[model samples]
Every structure is written in structure tokens, then in C-alpha cells.
Target: AQSVTQPDARVTVSEGASLQLRCKYSYSGTPYLFWYVQYPRQGLQLLLKYYSGDPVVQGVNGFEAEFIKSNSSFHLRKASVHWSDSAVYFCAVTGATGGNNKLTFGQGTVLSVIP
Candidate 1:
């Protein structure tokens, strides 16, 4: 079975500070990895995605993630964060089986930024 685990349920960081969110996944072969951000009462927006090719992938809003095959991890990083960046982060995975592209999400990590 394929699954993802986010070690931190919540992360609090001050404005203009660096941030890194951890994510680990369990899968057999090459899987589609994605990082999504959800704001208050809004739908999820894709931060980044790793299907193949490059191990490190960049996303919107200055977010980047590196896909580590050996460790089965895809951790998100940002050099600086802002108060507006405060939201929930979720790590997701999808396979090639098709049909709706059902994504299995992590429990979610709520990020709180203090201005």
C-alpha cells in the first residue's frame, strides 16, 4: 500500500524566518509526489510536484521540494516566510492507475506565522 506521513501536525514560525516542512512516503515504485497549500476556507493549490526527471522541484510562492528516493521523502523548504503564508500544508501522492487522480493526503500541517 502507498501512504504518506507528516511528522509535524503544526508548525509555528515568525515572519521572515526560514521554514522547512518534513514529509515521508511509502510506496513501491516511482510515484507522483506533490505539495499542496490550503488557505483559510479555500481549495488546495499545488505548491510543487515530482513525477520524474529532476529530484528537486520548485513551486509557486517560493516553495521548493527535493525528492529523495532512498529515504522516500519529499521535504518542502523556503528561505523566508511571511504572515500571508500562514496556512495548512499537505503532502500527497498519486499512482499511474488513472481514474480521477485520487490523491492520498497527509493529516496536514497547520503553519502559523507571527508578524
Candidate 2:
């Protein structure tokens, strides 16, 4: 079975500061990883995904994630953050099988960006 975990339940950073949200997975085989962000009243939006090829993948709004196979981790990072970036970020994992792509999500890490 595949599972995802976001160690930090909440993260705070000043505006324009760099950010990194930690994510770890438990899966024997290679699994599809995703980072999704949910704004105040909106649905979850895809930040970035890692299917194959490169270890690092770029996402929207200058967000990026690196897939480290050995560590079984896929951590999200950004060079700088804005106040708008403050939201709930979720780390999800799904196995590449069957038609139904069911994603297992972490508890979610709430980001707070101070001005």
C-alpha cells in the first residue's frame, strides 16, 4: 500500500522568504506523487507531479518538488513565497494501476505567510 505524510501540520514564513514543505511516502514501488494547494474557498489545485524522467519537477507559481527515491521522499520547495501563497498544502500519492486513480493524501500542512 502507498501512503503519504506531511510531518509539519503548520508552517509559517515571512513574505519573500524561501519555503519548503516536507513530504514522505511509504511505497515499495514507484508511485505517482502530487502536491496540491487549496486556496481559502477554492478546490485543490495541482502544484506539480512526478511521474518519471527527472527527479525534480516544476510546478505553478514558482513551486517545485524533488523526488528522492532513496529517501522515499518528495518535498516541495519555492525560491520565495508571497502572502497569496498562504494556504493548505496537501501531499498525495497514488499507484499507477487500474482505471480508478485513488489518491492517498496526508493530513495537510497549513502555510501562513506573514508580511
Winning model by lDDT: 2
Give the number of colliding residue pairs in candidate 1: 0
lDDT against the true structure, per candidate, is 0.92, 0.94
lDDT (Cα, tens digit) per residue for candidate 2, span 7-112 = 9999999999999999999976669999999999999999999999899999999999999999999999999999999999999998866536889999999999
Estimate the TM-score of every prediction: 0.94, 0.96
Q: Output the TM-score of candidate 2.
A: 0.96
Residue 6 of model 1 has an lDDT of: 97
lDDT of 2: 0.94
Per-residue lDDT over 15-43 for candidate 1, one digit per residue giving the tens place of the 0 to 100 score: 99999999999877668999999999999
lDDT for model 1: 0.92
